[model samples]
Target: MESLIDKDRIQVKFSAENQFAAIEMAAKPLWEQGYVDEGFLAAVMERERNFPTGLPTRVGVALPHTEAKYVIKEGISILTLDKPVLFAGMGNPKEKVLVEILFLLAIKNPAKQLGVLQTIITIIQNEMVLKKIKGAKDPKTIYNLINQFI
Candidate 1:
């Protein structure tokens, strides 16, 4: 399995206007690389609206995704915003979260979702990993930090 921090899918932006804008902007590189389909951006936005993936922690993170078919490739793409973006809460409907790190995953295998989720969970559970990801200054640093998991 390859790490998600591929050159084509990484974006380093200071801020995003809103959640939809953030997702669309981050998904562009993947779309351009043919890792995602034409409808993937819309689908991911819709899925996020319907079923939020926001996880509240010391350092809040969001795992935005849709079905596997939307992805033409199997990898993870990471986007870190200097300012946080708002995403609806996963366990709570009324609550909203400020997500600093967005793990935009493109997995073609539905069966791998569980393992991917597990890996994400484990990584986030560690305060150090979360801190490292949050403190990473560049895409390559973030990529190197996450590659340790694989």
Candidate 2:
């Protein structure tokens, strides 16, 4: 299996309009690297708009993602926004969240999808991991920390 992260896909944006913009920005590196199709970015955004992937952490954070087909490569793209962005809540649709860290996952295989999700779940469950990610100052730092876990 490919590693959960592709350092090439990591991005650090100081200004993002919203969560959708963040996801699109994060996915750009992957798209340019030829790891994802041209349509993958748009597809992911559409899927998310219709079916949100926000997962509320026990300590307060959300992990959002969509289907594996949106992936051009079997890797993760991470973004640390200068400001939080609102995303539809996972556990409660009525609620909204300002997610600081967005993990844009791209997994091509359907069978491997569960494994990727499990790995992400395990990583986020660790308070230290979440804290480190939240504390990360740049794309490299975030990429390094995620590499340690997956």
Best by lDDT: 1
lDDT per residue as tens, model 2, 1-150:
236676566666446888788777878777887777877888888877777766666434445456666665676777767777778887576678777677777777767877877777887889888778777767677777766766
> Which predicted model would earn the best TM-score?
1
Q: If candidate 1 were superposed on the true structure by all CA atoms, what would the RMSD be?
A: 1.5
Give the per-residue lDDT digits (tens) of candidate 1, residues 37-140: 99888999999989997888778788899998788887677777888888888988568888887888888887887788888888888889888888877777
lDDT of each: 0.80, 0.71
Q: List the residue pairs that clash in candidate 1.
A: 4-76
Residue-pair clash count for candidate 1: 1
* TM-score, per-candidate, Cα-based: 0.91, 0.85
